[model samples]
Target chain A: MKILQVEGLTKVYGKGDAQVKALDNVSFSVEKGEFIAVVGASGSGKSTLMHLIGGVDRPTTGKVQVDGKDIFTMNESNLAIFRRRNIGLIYQFYNLIPTLTAEENISLPYLLDRRRPNPEKLLEILGLLALTDRRTHLPGQLSGGQQQRVSIGRALINDPAVILADEPTGNLDSRKSRSIMELFKMFNRQYNQTLLIITHDEKIALQADRILTLEDGRILRDEAVRA
Target chain B: MWLSKRALETLSQNIRRIVDGESVDLLDNREGPLSILRNDIQTLVRMKQEQADALRHDKERLKDSLSDISHQLKTPLTSMMVMADLLETAPPEKHAELVRNLQTGLTRTQWLTDALLKMAKLDADAVAFNVRKADAREIVARALEPLNILLEMKGQDVRTAGEAELTCDVRWTAEALGNVIKNASEHSPAGKPILIACGENPIAAWISVTDSGEGLKPGQIARLFRRFQGDGTAGYGIGLPLAQTILRGQNGDIEVDGSGLPPHVAELTDEEYSGATFTLKLYR
Candidate 1:
């Protein structure tokens, strides 16, 4: 099943003289459980593309259908609710609450939705990330890798329909990066989570099922790594 | 007294079923000591079922391995028999060629048996790996050393880059890497360079060989490392499985990715296909 369909997405930042085309009519569809890597250098619109799909920023001229629902067509409040319920976003910087414990940080999504996270699922996610022992520790006390793992747990707490990660491992050393990648692989293989990661690193991109190269606000090439 | 006797009788039957490696479903939803006993019995039954399933899976795998190994040996054996039969009535002019053919066949058969025997030993936990800290660079060099003659003959080039210090059974790791490099060379076209690179992520010290040949098909990945499974025509098919066995013995693994990389990863202007990469990793 195709879970995501991006059609004729074009995002222009400003008016005539300072007009910047961040994304230029990009179109692609992602299947329900694909692990896709979007690669490009800086200013390649990869981030813009992610923001648009995440419904954080609406496209200037196009649509994004996620799980048969056109996310862009929804009103702002509807999109916010839709994104919170379906989209899990992880960032390069951990973006965790400074004073919140790892467990508390992971429970933020549920807290925002005015619902409590299932205790069993929260424990399982923590254990999967090997963060059970450090669940009580604040983000300030955790290492870079541990912080990222917590962020991953937060993303996964809702069992979101799709995971949108941008430069997830950019802040960590190679060793930490490998461990994080293994975590991603385990989720992909075991749970069949639909994941789309944007990275500039070719080595990291190689682990994904397919690679979409972005250049100058346009998709240069899209190729399967393991069809 | 009658109810207690019946309960004991049912419990005995469940124990017997478990002893026979059969699944037992005990129906006791009552909230009492009897229910607790039933809960424990249910857990045991689940464990027994899992064990039986695992044993069946193992047996199936063993059967497949045996069949594959026999097939590998049979090919060379059939060729050897035909050549021997020709030797008996061959003219003098063809005698040297026929003898050489027999020698080649014998050597190939010998190598196959030798590799299989080593694998069997590894599987049996007989070989004590002498682990030590070794330079990834030296290991790559050692792996490529024996391939020099064969690669030169095949008109292939190898490019080695990057380095990391890895703690492994240096000699055996070199042996395992050599197998992967050899597989890569076999698939690569003439004049194309096989790329070998090594580096470390915090969790692992690694080496990878990317061949500039046809990559793996979608279904091929599942069986790519099994015994006697190779890209049908090129190899006797022992190398990858053996490499996996060796690395796994040392707390490591091998990953093969032939996903169509653009021109840069394994590009030669003349070739239309991207090469697959086999990475040998030893975790830190």
Candidate 2:
């Protein structure tokens, strides 16, 4: 099933002559469990595209349909709740709460919704990320890689319909980068989760089932990679 | 009744001793039924002591690890916050530099987080390796392919030789070699040719990447694979360690030869090359 559909997604910053078209009328659809890599040079609107799809930022002129529901059409409060429940976002800097322990951070989404975290799923994710031992450690008390894994754990806690990652491994070394990719691939297969990752590394992009090349705020090429 | 009362008193005394953390000599208590009871209590006490000791040790180790993590995270985080603050207060022209510094700080923190995660997974033996037999040449090609852009940008040349089929996890092995190749290429001088050679022995197959870069100092060689031990200019010092973990997972190993000589330089004249060589080997 098409889990996400972007229609005429246009994101413009500023106005008039000083305006910047971050994403220019880009449209695409992603199937459930599909792994797609978005590649482009810096300032090519790759992040803008991700933000739009993730519903973190509104597009000036476009519609983002996730699970056949137009997320952008919702009010800000509803959109925030929808994003919290349905879109798992990972970033280059991890974006974890420094004061929260790994376990608390992973359970943040559930807490924000005033829902109890599933203990079984929490244990499973902690084991999957190999973070069982660091569960009590705050972000300040964890390594950069560990903190990122916690953020990843947080993203997975909600079991969102789609995951949007922007240069998730850009700050990692090649080994860690590969491991993070492995984790993503594992989740993509195990949970049948949809993934849209923005990356500059060709090797990482090639790991995706499909590659989307962006240039000047437009998808220049969309091609499937041979297994 | 009198004998039973005396036995109960003796047993209660021993239990009290055990509870007080005092050593009870079970062998000294030689009565028939009391002897058995004492022996069981002795075993329980010993087990409890061992468990306590193990728990204490684990707690200490965890404390140390947490301290290290805190140190690693704080450096970048502090820099980022300071830079962000400066950017807020500084002149417009200084904003760019401050923002750049902030970015660098953020990048460092992110790298540290990733490295720690991988380290934890490897330590926990939680990572699953998908091993398969594959062509050694193909793996090298895959590893080197991603690096072609970097090599070309640096005006570097690469030469490969001696292909051999080997049993390995193709994807992971490629990643390991890619890290080695990236390290070599980064340290190598511009326009210098990086040589990759593959060969097989009776028990194992190996590939070596040699680069025309300044060989490691003797001190650096000892701590080369040590996590977070680099000069901070090249990288966060996690790549090589992570590669080592990946290779070891597949019964493979990596060796560094910092003698300032390529392994294949024997075929050419002595003046032809001077650099470092890293060799990766996988058991057959």
Candidate 3:
């Protein structure tokens, strides 16, 4: 089944004299549980595509359907709720609140939605992230790897329709980066999680099941690593 | 204005570009015979591009293997030379162990060369596989014939379950399966039983080997089949690539399922399999 679809996706920036087409008629559908890596050089519109898909930003002309619901059609508040409930976003910089402990940071999503995370699932996430002992430690007090783990925990706390990460391990050392990738891979396999990672790192991209090469806002190639 | 009714000159130029080995960015609107003609032309260009890519890939692989083969051979050769010097100078009493060391080095070199040569043949399309329907048990038994001593040395165990009669080049299939089994044995803890299961599904007949070690780490599965591209966590060999080639030559392939949690493990855990499971799928 198709989990996400981008149809005639186009994004334009600035106006007439300084205008640039960030994305150009891009269209693709992601199957359920697919782990895809979008790779491209800088200014390839990778971030624009991701932002549009995450529903954080709207395209100038396009349609994004998340699990069959057209996100652009929804109002801003409804879109925010839908995004929080269905889309999980992870960034290169560990986006944890300074005052929030590891546990609190992970629980932020739930707090925002006026919901309570299941205690058992929370415990499982902490334990899985190897942050059981560091649960109360603030992001500032933890190492880069630990901080990233907390972010991962936050992403999974909701069990969203799909997980979208941009340069997720680009901030860590090789060893730490590998451990983070392992966590992502593990979740993908056990739960059949739908994952889309935007990375400039070829090694990281190769780990995915398919690679989509974007150049100048266009999908240059779509290759299956394992079909 | 109909989308497909674009100027005749533009369509001719686009078709001309495809014929001249250039990729034409396809617009998302087309219908009828014009679409079919355009598609076929695009396919031809794609295939041409793919063939060129395949050629470059093969060249890169050749370079990698050349370096790998030399590196592998140099170790034993250098060691043997050192041993030869020690034997000439050392007394006869020490000469015994010296000779034994030299012999070991020779055996390793021989094995490495032999395997590399076989792989080269596979690469060159020199090996003509004899495809036939064969007993799964018989092939499994044959594959294990050479590994018995290694397994016995480590006190390892093998358990066979289920069975399937698959169409394949039995000896080559056995050879390929054996290499995979060998890898599993290396990963598995000593005395742990490696389960071999054979069965046929609607798509293909398969023989799967499940080892008792922690499954592959992140990023390992993708490179597992590449020649000499071992997962950094474990020492792998050219055997996997060879197995892959042999199977592919006969319309078969190898797949690995390294989901950390085993099938029965419902809870969250990072344990990869009981270990990793490798399955050799032979198309029916």
Candidate 4:
């Protein structure tokens, strides 16, 4: 099933001559459980593309269909729910609630759904993330790597249809980076989870099942790896 | 009687010195039964001091653990209460969002509680491993089964070679291999093949899962198996470590060689990119 579809996606910042087309006429579709890596240099609108697809920002012109529903057509409130329930967003800086403990941040999506998190699933996730001990530690108390894990936990907690990560491992060292990639792969395989990651690292990009290279807000290449 | 009084006085002085954290040489100038008494007292004091230190350390650890638990619980509780208050006064349109936020808070608290309980069990070594002889191919098959759907979605294939019979707790070993294979499969690109080669020697049985992805750097290879050692990129640093623990319990070990070419060039190489090769070895 095609879980995410982006068509004619465009986002302009500022106005007139000062207007910046961060993402210019970008169009792509992601299959369910597909692991995609988006790579581009700085100022190529990589983050902008992510934000538009994530519904954190609206596209100036275009359509985004998540699970066949036009996300832009929904009202702001409905979009918020859709984003919470279907889209799991991960960032380089983690963006965790500093005041909340690791476990709280992971379960935020569930809380947003006004439902209880499944205990068994939660335990499995904590075990998978190796966060059993750090569950109680606040983000401030956690190391950079640990905080990112919590953020990833938050993203996975909802079992969203699509996980959109922007430089999810940018701040991590190579070991952490490898582990993080392994984790994304684990979820993609174990649960058939769909992933769209934006990264600048060539090595990281190459791990994806499909590599999408963006240049100046346009897709320069969308190639599959031939074994 | 005079000698006995003198000995009593020395003993009292030595006890005082020990209590004050000062060193005392009780047997330096003594001989006979007095020296023996002095040696016994010194041993007794040393044992008591060690016990006190251990107790103090445990107490400190317990204190930190309790504080962490309370703080973890409090944050969600506080957030939920705030959300509930907002919900009460929130406009009808805002109520749904607030309710969602409120529920998220409760869910976090619940997850934390459950995670803590499981962690406690793992810490207490409450999980028992059932070790027995099993077919290595069967173990690999079981491990790869869950990932079949994902592999098919990615248009990837896992190829297994060689076969060996080994003594292991099939379930736990499979779980460990599953994690390793999952890691390898994720790093490998679509259409790329993940190779699982099994072999046995006089002393051990081994399986190596290799992927054609960007191999790990030297530093990364060093810390790959450490628990909670994520680089803040993707993982919580649990799976591999758990796999390690499981293997270790079964008299087995995991090794990774990430010295292969970069992931991009790995595709061009006939040697499977060497991005990473995780080898699981179990002693016979």
lDDT of 2 by residue, A88-154 (tens): 9999999998888899999997787556678999998898788999999989998878888998988
**Candidate 2 or 3, higher TM-score?**
3
User: DockQ scores for all the models shown?
Assistant: 0.05, 0.01, 0.04, 0.01
Ten contiguous residues minimizing lDDT sum, candidate 1 chain B: B262-271
Of the candidates numbered 1 and 4, which has the greater TM-score value? 1
Question: Candidate 2, after superposition: displacement of residue B243 in Å?
Answer: 27
> What number of clashing residue pairs does each candidate have, in the order they appear?
4, 8, 3, 9
Write down the worst ten-residue block by lDDT for model 4 chain B: B261-270
Ranking by lDDT: 1, 3, 2, 4
- Predicted structure with the largest lDDT when compared to the true one: 1
Worst 10 residues of 2 chain A by lDDT: A184-193
Expressed as tens digits, the lDDT of each residue in B39-135 for candidate 2 is 4465465456545765776677567667777777887887788778888779999988887787777777786797688777875679887777788
lDDT (Cα) of model 3: 0.79
RMSD of 3: 16.5
Candidate 1 residue lDDT tens string, A1-227: 56689999999999999999999999999976689999999999999999999999988999998766677666777577667667899999989999889999999877865567899998888887888999999999999999999999888887666899999999998757867986786676555678999999987887787889999999999987653
> Which pairs clash inside model 4?
A106-A154, A111-B103, A111-B104, A112-B100, A145-B232, A169-B233, A176-B231, A180-B234, A180-B235
TM-score of 4: 0.50
- All candidates' TM-scores? 0.58, 0.47, 0.56, 0.50
What's the lDDT for all of these models?
0.80, 0.77, 0.79, 0.75
